[model samples]
Each structure stands twice: as structure tokens, then as C-alpha cells.
Target: MKIIVLTSWLILSVSIAFSNAYMPLKDTELESIASQFPPLEYLNPLDDGGLLQPFLIVRIPGTENSTKVQNHVNDFFIKQISQGQNSSSSEIPMWKVTHDSFQDSTPIGDNITFTNICVSRDPELAINEGDKARTRKRLTLAAHYDSKLYPEGFIGAIDSAVPCAILMYVAKVIDKALTRKQAFLNENGVGNENNQLGLQILFLDGEEAFHEWTSTDSIYGARHLAARMENEDIENVDGLIGSGLSSIDTFVLLDLLGAANPRIPSYFSETHDLYNSMRSIQKRGRNIKGLFQHKRRESNFFSSPSVSENVHFLGGTLGDDHTPFWQRGVPVLHLIPNKFPPQWHHLTDDVDHLDLRTVHDWAIIIAAFTAEYLELTNFILDQ
Candidate 1:
């Protein structure tokens, strides 16, 4: 995790917009999304083939371990999700995988290459010639895939390992729902309305600083990608000219998660309502039986709106991967805890220190949140 500082300039300078009302998923819809797959299927530490186990290593930038982890993410999206799907066939939904690789000088006086793996399932991305869907909005979910350089063997389980695995799980669960929705629309001979939002999952590299935290050293991948996307133009299908950055509805960055009894506070006032939506999702999960196996002795994972509202004026937002995007006018929902975990940046931050119950519950909460955000409830229920 990058060092957090309370900068008043950052709070006053970034753009703010009124958040729209989020439609709360019904109880049955919540249950259906939660039960679509086992919450622990990808997060289980004992399962070698699962997403979590492969990330339990020291993956510093430009290292062999980092390449291995990057390949794992690529394989899941390319081979697993987009394996048999024919691009010519609109009935089958496919994920578009792209890599943003660049090299820069580090604080250690060495230049190394870093790659950001981006996988997206845009409903309107590529269909038949006449049936091409125009990409409108995307709910971008992101997390860093690199560990700190100081610790020789730091696994960074809670630092970001578990958060990366959680994203993979979310993508896998939502892919099925998306496939069904596309198939249903195709069968009914109905086009996807302009309101349908796309899902993009980013596995960023070089989030950690080589030596100490600084403006240039930390968040290497985010700074590079944000600048690149700002200028890169997407192929216009509906005569709409927009950069990749403009298409993002919201950028949700998860960090320092997977610890037991974490208190995640809402930082920006603009996205507080979106934060409340997540809080509402977490509250609604309690109503579904067996959704949360182990209850935290402390407060819920999300701090109450009443309590978090005060944090807006305190300038308590952390300097993280979202900083670059937020500076570029992106509405960011930073989901890191107010207080860093005790095991943060320590050798004990390995897999043994992770809480299975907290890990499992977070997977469900985030999965449910994504389902509602993408409006997958109607399609998932149809399945």
C-alpha cells in the first residue's frame, strides 16, 4: 500500500459530480447472484488451481514472479473466459484482453518494464457488421498486482494479493450472467439498449515504489496508463468521439483488504452515494442466510455514512492508484480501509495472516455489488 497523506489541495481541486440513484437489488436477486457460484471457489488458499494461491508470492516489478502472476491473469481471461467463443458469433460474449507495457527509470537507478493487464467484456464492443454495439459506459474495477520491494519474500496477501483474486472471481461469476443476457437478447431479436454498461477489470503493475514512496516512484502503472488512455481514441461506431478515459463511469480501486474486521470509509463526497450503495449491498447480504459465515466482533466492513460523512472535510483520502485517474476527472470510489492492516508491509502479511472468513465474505460483497452495478440481476435471474 502507498503511503496515505491528507492533502487539502487534492480534495479541493478534483472534479465533483452528483451521483445518480443506484437501484438496489431485490432479496431474491441478491441471493441468486450470491449463489451463482461458491464465494470461496477462487479465493481458497488450499486450491492450487484457484486464483488466490498463484498470487501468494513476491511479485515485484520486472521480476520472474511478476511475469508469472501476470500470465495467470491473462490465462484466466483469455483461455478460461474467452476460449471457445467465436468473435463472429454474437451469441457468445467475449472478453477483450489488452496489455499496456512500458519501461521507466526507478529510484534504484535502474529502468524496468511494467505491464498493465486490462480485460473487459463490452456488450457493444464487437458484434456482426451491422449489429456492432456502441461502447458507452464502463464500470472499471482495478487493483495493483505488485508487491513492495523492501521485503525480500513479502507475499502481500492483504496488501493486494487477495484483492486481485477477488476481481478474477467477480469476472468469472459475471461472465456467465453476461453470456445468458446476450443469448436472451439475441434469441428475442432485441438490441441492447444504450443504457447497458460494460465491465472492465484491470490488473495494474508497479504500484509499489522501488525504495521509498514518492510522486514518481509510486503508482508507475496507473500514471502511465491514465496518461495513455487520455489520448488513445476508441474506434467510433456511432459517430461518437471519446477517449478511453471519458468512457469510464466510475473507477473503483481496492487495496489493503482481506483482513478481518476492516473499516472501509468513504473518502470522496461525490462518490459517497456509490459508497452507500456498496454499504447497502453489504447490509442486504446479511439478510441472505449463510451469506456471511463469520461475523466480525467489530463494526461492519464499510463504515456508516453518518460516520464517514465527517471524513470528507478531514482530507483523509489516501494517495493510491486512483490518484492519477481522479486528477484526470475520473469519479473514483477508493475502497481501502481507513487504518492500514497490522500486517501491512510486513513479512507476516503472507497467506497465514489472512482471515478466511473475511476473505470469503468480501468476495461475496464485491460480487453482489458488481452484479447490481452492471444490471445483471434481470439476466442472472433469467438463468
Candidate 2:
């Protein structure tokens, strides 16, 4: 993704209201969720079935390695999640997978095909209710899986490989909690009225520019998918009509992470409260033993939410996959460091340079944040 400076006028003119309440997890609850799954199973490079390995290759759009990475994502949702279930049994709740594929011209003088993979875990009542599914709001986590094309054998570990792996880990850790919540709702017969929220993960393609960064060359998959969602109308309920993009409660995009001692800032004012909530979660995680392995660092990954009135004049926001959706009025939380890692866009940005402790810490913090955002603390604790 390319970094474009935000104009002061544009930043000041934007107004959005976010009204979601965040319920913080207890110390024991955070420890329970963090310990449910192996922290380094997905981020470790030595693990053969890990999520980061397939992404550690040169996976440009319309290439063989790109397809391999896409297959790896699909297999996780299908085979890994569906383990021990019979073919015809619906005992386990599965993620509904969909794809948005298209062809577009790039600066490289070729039309490349890009596909965006989306998987969701909607409530059972929403699935059975069919047309009323639009009433369910989605909390989306996204990261681009495509690598840069300029430098040969560039892996983009911190550029986005670690971000993608972190998303996968979030999905895996929250699956059981989501299932338990669904069962509780069904047992109580609350239907979709109680919790009309779901989880969606997107693995985007063609995020890197072919040559120089331009408006049309960068974020090809995001541009197409955002436009398509804008056209599709949501089913009206209570005389309220909205597009598919409006169904999103918040769009959280992760990029340029997994490096040590990185500082992330709150880019948008609308989601500043949510950013603070994440910072609180990270603080709670630091107290948990064996969670944060680094002993010397006492600072947090996120910067203080307080900022000067002239923050926008100092190039506050960035141009990335979230730009397309944010332009259409979706509440976005951009979780990239204020200053990028030392290996940004370099050929040395590989698995060897990533900090394992930082990688595992991110997996814990993000998973805990997802649980709190979805209001799954009670169900997660019951498990």
C-alpha cells in the first residue's frame, strides 16, 4: 500500500459518529483466551502448517505463488476448522466463504485478475432467515496478501505477511467463542435480536504497485470490492435502507506490523475511542505472565490518544486498502506504526528479521480485542 499525505481541509471536513460500547475483559479471561490456542503456531516460520510460510514467498498478482497462498487461506477455513465433523453434519458452525474476482489494467501494460477472499460467521438465525441477513452488522479484519514485484524474492514480512498471519490467528482463537454464543442464543430463543453482529476476514490481492505508485495502480482489489459493495443494496428493516458497505460496524485494516518496539497512532477521530480500548487491552496483556516475552521494553505498542489540534497538518492519515472504504463513510481503524519498520520495502524484509516475541504479543492483543468488540466475554469465559 502507498502512503499519501492527507490534506488538512479533507481531514477537518470529515465527520462520523461511532457509538459502539467496549467491554474490557478481565485478567483471567484475557489469559484464558490467550492460552486457548498456541501463540506462535501461525507466526513461526519453522512450523510447516503455519499461516506465515505460504505468505513468505514472492506472491504477485496472477502468479503461481499467489494462487498457492489463496489456497492456503481457503484450506484453513474448510479443512482445519471443519476437523472431526462428518460430511453431512451441521454440528459445527462454518464460515461462509465468498470471492470477488475481476480484471483491471495496470501500469505494467497488462490486465491482471485479482480476487478478494471473504469469510463470515453470521448467527444461525441470520443464515436461516435469508433476506434479513443484512440486519447483522459485521466487524471486519483485513490485510493484503500480495507481495511487491520490483525487487526479486521480496517476502514483505513486516510489510504485510505478519499482518495477514495475525488475522488468521484471530479467527482461529475466536471460533469456539462464537460457537458458544450461538448456542446460548439458540437455547434462550433470542433469535437475531440480541446479537446481530458477525466476524468477517478479508485477504486482499494486488496491494503493491507494479512500477510507481499511482491512484489507479495501488490497492486494486480494495477499489473493485468497495465499489461492488456500494452498488449492492441492503435489505431494508424498520424502513431503513443502506448498502452492503453500511452493514460494516467498523473496518479494521492491519499493515506494517510485527516489528519490535513499533508505535501505532490513532489516525481517525471517529475511532479514537476504539483505539484507546485496544491500548487498554495491550496494557492488560503486559501483566499476564509469558504473554509479552520482551523484558526490557516497558512501553506500549500504541501511542497516547491525546494529540494536538494540528495533527492533521502533520500527515496524519495514510493511503492504503482502507482508503476506498473510508471514502464511502465506513468507520476505519488503521493499525500501522507512525514510522514504518527499518525493513520497509527492502529485500531484507524476510522471516529472519521478524521478532517472534512481538509477533506472539500481537496475536494475543488482537484476539482479545475481537472478543471484547463482539461482546463475547461471557461466552468465552463459560468455555
Candidate 3:
């Protein structure tokens, strides 16, 4: 009789604990994670004529200098996993580079090639009847590391440097979190293992236009890669997520970050739900100093969040790296400031003018949105 009573109490305790622990993400927590990125000094180019030396995602076939730059970016993500403090180091991801060539009527040539960089962790194969079964879904986080050209100089810190740096740290934090989770499961030997979705980071190339934004001009790398992925024979491929073009669950793109109270207006008709979900996540995090402490406040998910309705966007639409994927009907979440910063596209945009708080806020929003999408709130709580 005593054993039965104890078992019932234990089960009830476990249920209650799980329920109580699943809390929404906090700003302070995300800020700490965002701090993992190096300071502004390391984010920009050498502040000379060197921008074109390496940032020429515009030139035909790209350049070895830019490839070296791409590799330099990849090295940061790799280093965090290899030398991360207070996190498991096993199962570090590798960057998958695919050199894509496309036809371009440029002054230099017609056939232009650009290299795309991808980093992702393969999901553990499902066990079913002594054979591999379904593979877990994938969530992609993308940012264009390559910048447009300028006659004088285009460091483009706000143009893309902020987003790229934020993603670098986001990858680092998520990698550490995932490794820690795997280690936890290893030690405890408990819980359903396949309850998580895999993460894929895509740092695209050739996002900016060599000349102007045309149906065929901008997003050269994105266009080629998306078309290529769509054409691949999925049947022959093993672990192609779930579907070929449909393998990706959501492709969230970040741009024009690191400004004070930046506006993020929704554009795409399909991404309304996803955008709302993200907005709700941001709303929940900005409630108060300690709103989460009160159980009552937790219910108010989106109470008076940040907004700047007076600010206008570019034709109520945006042309960015996600255009190619969105053309294929892939769900895209475009996180760009509604009011494009004053220093946009000009030489004035640099690390000295960027706002760290806004950058930190962006990191928080992106990470929190991803965690919610993957249903990892409990994971946050568990930690």
C-alpha cells in the first residue's frame, strides 16, 4: 500500500515540475548569450579599400580572397564548438560549401560563380523494426555574409555585419545548448530522444546586386542554390529531411539589425502567422523587470510590445536574400527594420554607429522565436 502511494505521488510530482518549469525566454538570458560574439573591432573589414578585396560577392566566379573571408567566418563557428567554455564539445558541425555558377550579363563575364556556405547537424536516425525510419525535420537560420560593392568603400556594418555577427553567436549558443542536451541524455538515459528538430545555418553568398535589383540580378547565390536543391533527385538521396523542396520547416532571415527600436513590419502574406508568433515571443520577453515571477503575468503573452507604426517600409515589401526561397513557396520570416537606418547602403554604416542593445535584442528575438518554433521552451526550463 505504501509503495503504491509513493509511486502515485512521484508521478504527480514529475508532472507538476515539468509544467512549472516551462517558462518563456528572458531578455537577460538572451543578452548573455549574444555577448559570446567578438567585439565590433573584429566584425568589420580593415576600414580601407579592402572591402572589395574580400567582399566582392559581386565579381564573376567570386574571388579567392572572398573564399578566404568565407572560411574566416566559418572558423569562428567551429572555434566556439571546439573551445566553448562550460559546454560539451562533441559533435561540432562542419561548413558545406557549394560553388554555384549562374549566367550573368556583366561587364567582366557571363558565367558568374558564387560559393554558398551551410552548417547543420544530422539528426539521429529513427529506429523502426531494426532499420532506419524517418529523419527529423530541419529549421534553417540564414544570413548573407557577402556584401555589395562600392567605388570608395562599403563596409556595410548595418547592411549585414550586425546580422552576420548575431548569427555567428546564435550558432555558437545553440551548438553549446545542443551538445549539453546530448550530454544530459547520455548521462540520464531518459526521455524521448527524437522530440527535437535539427538546426541548419546557411550563410549565403552573392546577396547584393552587382549593378541593380532586377528579377535576375540580386540574390544570385540564393537563386542558384534554391533551384539546385529543388532539382535534386530526392529518391536517391538518403535523409533528405522529409521532402526535397519541403525539407526545410522555416527559413528565418535577418537583416538591417542593430538600431534603436527598429521597426519590423510584416510583408509576406504567407508569413503572417510566423511573424505573429515571433512578435508574440518578443512581446512576452519585454513585459517587465520581473513579470515572469508572477504566475498571473505569464498568461499575458503579448502585452504592449514595441512598435513604430508611423515608420514606413519600402513599398510595403522587401527584396532580400529570401526572395528565391520565397518564390518557391518556402515559408520565410523577414526580420528587417521597417525604417531602414539612415546610414543604409552609405559608407557611413559601420560598427561605430551601430547600437549594441538593438543587436542584443535581435539576438534574443531570433533565438526565442526559434526555440518556440522547435518547442524547446521546456529545454530552456530544464537547463
Candidate 4:
């Protein structure tokens, strides 16, 4: 009994000592990052007959385009991985990067490929190159890469392309924060507990059903991946450092973003704090110029809102990508527009339906909340 108590106390002390380790990224840096975007190069793609088409149709699992997009995102993650591994501590690319891949035949009748791109310092962490140290406390940013079906080609710019791109951009902005944290730990000779801060950006395949939205059709990738995690005994619910428990502290799913009118509500009671954090970040972003010009809605059940004509609050989950993880008891924060645009799941859900400013605000707010949750701020409490 005494030994257990002593161990617990020691762990607490170490945690507090490293509590101040995380560093907050500045809004100015975020603005600079946002400014570099309009990176349309990633958007336009070859349709057919040697012509480029804006529409991205249902990239079904195991198909050429599906693999191409997966490899693209995986390669995007690897660029930073190479930078970090090749460079010294001073040059530890803005973000520590690595990834994991899951492939299997799903209940939906097709073999699927799911790739989870990570920005982290977990020592079993493998870049596209190889593995590193084991992972620790994690915060994940998730979105599906596959666009839904439409009569005409479907780009799904708002359906999810913007959200996926936003995660990539957020990962880019977060690189600085991760490196800054690493730099501090190195200079102070603080044990690399900050390595526990994990950032996972998942570009899930097969989010759109091959036929229709059904238990057997939709989320082919997520269902397989979640089951596999459980099978491997990787998920840890009450541990500070382990495989899956440390692999993901919270899973945040972003979908249907970058539309003109946006309304995100606190979907799950358990994830309310994280949801509120996004809201807090939203309010904070008001000072950041060129961010969130459109009026946004918030759902605070506890307090009465200012009865303006504009009101935003969601009562329950939207049954998007977070469904599988949420059911498995993984903490989930769903960031989806409550009032989905009329173009949702339609051929018209293309760039013409997207707002760059909305994209910027979504990226920044999510980045801010993620920074806060990871304790990446220099402001350590008086523990």
C-alpha cells in the first residue's frame, strides 16, 4: 500500500513539473500560416479524357483515386517527418511526424485502406521512414478524404474537402508549437514528457458509402480501424501513458466546414468541455482580423443565450465519422455545421460553395482548442 501511494505521488510530482512545458502558438503565426494558403494546387485534379475537373466523385475503397489521395496525405505528413529526422533539434521541423496504416476486408464487402497521419513525438512513432519511440497522451483531428457520390462528379469542397485541408493546415500551424515545446524541454534538460503530446490528423477512407448509408456500407474504414484497435488491446481508458490510451486522448471529427452559415453545437454531454473550448476559441478569434466574418452559433445548455435572431446549439450527435469511436468509449468532439448547406452531398458542394474566411476561422479555432487541450501553453497552473 505504501509503495503504491509513493509511486502515485512521484508520478504526480513529475506531471506538475512538466505541466508548464506546453507552449501556446501565437495568433500572428496562425495568420501567417493562413495567408500562405489558397493552396489551390491541392484542389484541382484530373477528371477524365485529359481534362481537369473540380468535382471529386466517390473515391471507393481500393480504387486508384482513393489510393492516390491517401498517399498524398500520407506524403504530406512525411514531408515534416523527414524534416524532423534529418535536421537537428534546432531544426526539428515545425511538427514531429509519423503515421499508421490499416488495411482489411470490411463488412461492406470491399478491402479498405485507412491511413492515420500523425504529428507527434511518440518514440514507436514511425515516419513514412520507420518507427521511433512509443506514443503518449494524444489529441486527434479527424476527417474523411473520400467524397460522396453525385450524378455529376462531387468535389465535396464543403462536404469535407475544406475540413480535411483545414486539418492539414492546422497540423502545419501546430508544427511550431510542437517544436517550441521540444526546444524548451531540450534546453531545460526536462525529461521528454512533452513527447506524450500527440497530434493525429486522420484522413479516413470510405466515409461515403459505396451504395447507401447503412451499418454495412458507411464508414468502412473507421469501423475496421476501431475494431482492430480493440482487438490489439491497444486502447487504454485510464492511463497517462500506454499504447491506445496514449495513442488518443480525444478524437475530434471535423466535417461539412467552410460554408457561409455555420452552427456547431455541444453534441455529447461528456465532450462538452472540449466543445466549449472551441466556443471560447471562437470568441477569442474575434480579435484576429480576417477570421470568422460570418456570425457563428454556440450551444450552451447551462445558460440562457442572448435571444438574438441568430442562435446556435445542437443537442445530439450528427452520426458522422465520430460514431465508431464514440461507441467504443473514446472521447469525441464533433465539429460539424448544424445547418448543413443545401449543397451537402450534392454535385454543387464544390469550391464555389466554400468561403476561404470560414475555412481560416475553423482551422484557427480548432488549432487553438487543440493547443489548449494539449497544455501546449507556457502558462502552467500553480500546481
* TM-score for each candidate, following the candidate numbering: 0.90, 0.91, 0.71, 0.72
Preferred candidate (TM-score higher): 1 or 2: 2
| Candidate numbers sorted by lDDT from highest down | 1, 2, 4, 3
Task: Give the count of colliding residue pairs in each prediction.
Answer: 0, 0, 1, 13
Best by lDDT: 1
Question: Which one wins by TM-score: 1 or 4?
Answer: 1
lDDT, model 2, position 93: 53
TM-score for predicted model 4 compared with the true structure? 0.72
RMSD of 4: 10.1
In model 1, which regions exceed 4 Å deviation? Answer: 10-21, 82-90, 125-134, 189-194, 235-238, 295-298, 313-316
List, residue by residue over 266-374, the lDDT tens digit for candidate 4. Answer: 6555566556556656665566675544443442211222421123433222456766676666767777755677777777776676765565566667766666666
Please, what are the lDDT tens digits per residue for candidate 3 over residues 293-378?
22243322222233323323222245677766766667666777656778777767766676655555566566666655544543
What does candidate 1's lDDT look like per residue over 152-260, in tens digits?
8888998799999999988877777787776766666664433246778999999988888888889999999999988978644445677778777789999988987
**Candidates, ranked, TM-score:** 2, 1, 4, 3
Which residue pairs collide in model 2, if any? none
Clashing residue pairs for model 3? 263-338
Worst 10 residues of 2 by lDDT: 307-316
Between candidates 3 and 4, the one scoring higher on TM-score is 4
